[model samples]
Target: MKLARRLQAIKPSATLALNARAKALAASGKDVVVLAAGEPDFDTPEFVKQAAIEALRTGFTKYTATAGMPELREAVCRKLEKDNGLKYAPEQVVVTAGGKQSLYNCFQALLDEGDEVIIFAPYWVSYPDMVHLAGGTPVIVPTREEDGYAPDPAAIKKALTPRTRAIILNSPANPTGAVYSRATLEGIADAVRGHDCFIVTDDMYEKLLYTGEPFLNLGNVAPDLVPRLLVSNGLSKSYAMTGWRLGYAAGPKALISGMQLVQDQSTSNASSITQKAALAALNGPTDTITAMVNEYRERRDLFVAGLNAIPGIRCRLPEGAFYAMADVRGLLGKTYKGKPLTDSLQLSEALLNDFLVAAVPGDPFGAPGYIRMSFVTSREVLQKGLTRLRDFVAALG
Candidate 1:
């Protein structure tokens, strides 16, 4: 059996790979503290779970419309209007397996061979692979830690070429947790407004903010670009519904229809019960989300403080999301139990093997001297993990 060239070009998700390795280690009786996977540690809220249970009991097991159930689409529209300040007709929204599929649909529907998509580093690991799978080129624009890892509009403009077709924006970003300010988003929006390009905003973490900064939904911030903008979101992160496999998006009717056609040919629709649960999640009381955010905020503060207290580690206080990307360059070339720490991967392995702490290496995110630690665990686990990290680094010195 032979695989297609495109299929062969794809790489496994580094986060999941690390997580699997950590889990295997733990199963072997070695205690492992995993901070690599991105899913929230909380259980899915009771209301959302109950909705799915009710759907199952009611025999709501039939196929839904490829675009989504009308009620769910309407609920999504209401969510956009209420939370994102964007009004969308139900026809313009489509729910898929998850935000990953929504984004894959966008790339599949929009890109042609040789089209270029600008992705900022340290981007989510799947973006470039998805672009390649869609026959598009991924042009990576690197941002610095000193800049809060925010991509400058000017730099993005400089990277644009005649073949540039799209730009991806992920705020409360993965791996780095760098939230774009309203001004920054506006500048980028303004830069690409008249250009013959589309913008795909991944607002998966829109509700996970901690810094009290107003989230500027790019689609709402620049309505003129709505026809070309695709906003992808899901229930995985905020609602702690990773196993539900529900995600959605709103865009121009034409694009949504194209995506619907793709979904019809491919996934057909998200799970019927999952859609019901997602509908409940969107329409039910949002107080659980508020409570989760509050707890995450406290955890973020505690984790950031702990990371900063360690020698040779400098972590930026993340503005949103649940990650702490700490620069470990100060520890490079230092010896850890007679083994030299060379880069992020080596540091990660040393931490896991020596201190039983597991984190994802930044090399996968295009930054090699940093490591991403998720703070979505309990305060007790966070404190112990930080203590292990501190002791490990101190031993290195």
Candidate 2:
């Protein structure tokens, strides 16, 4: 059967592929330790879960407006204003199935054929594919680790062309765990403010920051460009409600409306119960954020330090997020178990099959010679995983 050609542009998620491989191995009675998860290991807060139960008991399971429930949208507005310093009306918000959907809706609504979208390398695996699926070309601008993964404004300017339609900014970024400082965000904002394009800020991991500073959104730092910015976030990461599939976006009324119309035709209004639960999560005690952030900070330190201690692996200390991107280039170009470990993909396969450790390789993320490991697991599990990783390196020679 012939499939739509658009589907051909979108690459299958590498994170999901490795995670599923690990799960399959474990299912087949192999002891696999998976560090590939993008979701938090923590369960949703009890209060949030109780809110969903209450909604169910009240028989509030009907289809909501294609955008979302009124209360949920208003709650999102409040959360944005309070946390991000980005003010918006409830009408400017659109809730969707998940943060992934919110981003997809934006791309579908805005991108024209051959439009260009700028992305950072070592980006989240989905950003490039989402742009391609929307018929837009992904222009990836690689960031240097020496600069702590902060993208340079000069480099961004060089990548811009008249075809540039938008840029996707992921702070406390995936794979690299790099947080874009307010100064850095403003620099890029200033660089592109005159462009006839938009910026889609993915702030999904904002609340998981381990840095000793408050989270900063690009929209908040550069208020002048707010009219052209779309802020996308979800209940999944911050609230530990990934399975609930609730996410939202806020932007200019026109863009939000366009996204809503796209949703109206696709999957209208994320699950009704999930919206209610998300509302509870936004309004309930944010003390949960502090607790979870604290635990993740501990795990991040342990994993980064352990990786750095290994003879061949070099790791960067992430200021925010629960991931550690380790430079495994030293282990490449060598033989592992009589097989050539020429690249990250082959290195990852060796790690999983021979060493029982699973990780997402860097090639799919546009940064070869590296591997991304989530410290989202507990300290005990993280210790064991790091030990296995270290031992695997030691035995590689």
Candidate 3:
């Protein structure tokens, strides 16, 4: 049997892999506390569910237009206008199965073989893999926890080249929870002006922010750049509709059309029923979103504070999303049960095996000496996980 060389350049998602391992451990009767999930723990709002039920009842379970249902795209446009202050028409939007597919579509639509995609380190686990699978080179630029994991505009500018096709931005990011400041976003927007590279902004966590400020979008900051920016968002995190699998991207008509063509050749349209549900999520009440954000703020404050109080674990205060990247660098060069605990991967294994806790190692996220813990669970479970984490770190010598 022959395997494609592309497979050699990619690894399975560390978050999903660890989640499966945790579920398996729990099924075996182990007291496994899994903290690797990236979705909100909240249930989908009743209104959204009701809308989907009605869609099914009305025989709306068939395929939609390749770009999306017209109304759904209109709803997405309204969301951008009302929420992010960015304007778009339905023709400039492409509804994807999830935000992931929008990104995949962008990679496929724009990237040629050996073209470069700029990605910030400690990024979403899937970005580089998506680039590689699309035959684009992923050029990773390092960022520091001290800087809140925000990509520097100067560094991004430095990474740009003739072959650079796009720069991926994820604010209120996955696994890190670092939201880009408005100034930073503006700087990025200003720097990339007139450049051929597109700014691919992933706003999956836009509504999940703990910050009091409104969601900062590059397109909103520099509307002139909107034609070159792709703002990809979905109802997964914000609306607690991960399984609903409806994501949409708004950008230039040409790019959106290209992404739609890629989607057309592949999955065609997103689920028609899910598209209806997403329409309700965007156009219906946002009170559910507010409630979820409030709960996540409480959990994040409790969990990050608890982690920072631990002897060797230090977690920065995350600005948004539901994750905390715990810096276990202080725990390295130490020993656990006569074996050297040297890297983030080894420490994550000890946490999973010996401590009966599951966490994704930061190595896969391009930030080793740390591990990511998601607070997308009950406060009780989070507290228990933190206690176990403390005990495990204390056992290290």
- Give, for candidate 3, the lowest lDDT window spanning 10 residues: 185-194
Model 2, 1-397: lDDT tens digits are 9999989877789999999999999999987888999999999999999999999999999999999999999999999999989999999999999999999999999999999999999799999999898899999999999998889899899999999999989998998999998889988998898788999999999998877888998877788889999999998999988889999999999999999999999898899999889999999998887899999998888889889999889999988878889999999977787776899999888889888899989999988999999988888888889889878887876
TM-score of each predicted structure versus truth = 0.97, 0.98, 0.98
lDDT digits (tens) for residues 93-150 of candidate 1: 9999999999999989888998999999998999999999999999999988788887
Write model 3 residue lDDT over 101-166, tens digit each, in one string.
999999999999999999999899999999999999999999888888877878888888999999
Off by over 4 Å in 2: none
Candidate 1 CA-lDDT value: 0.90
Better of 1 and 3 by TM-score: 3
- Model 1 spans > 4 angstroms off: none
How many steric overlaps does candidate 3 have?
A: 0
What TM-score does structure 3 among the candidates reach? 0.98
lDDT of 3 at 365: 93
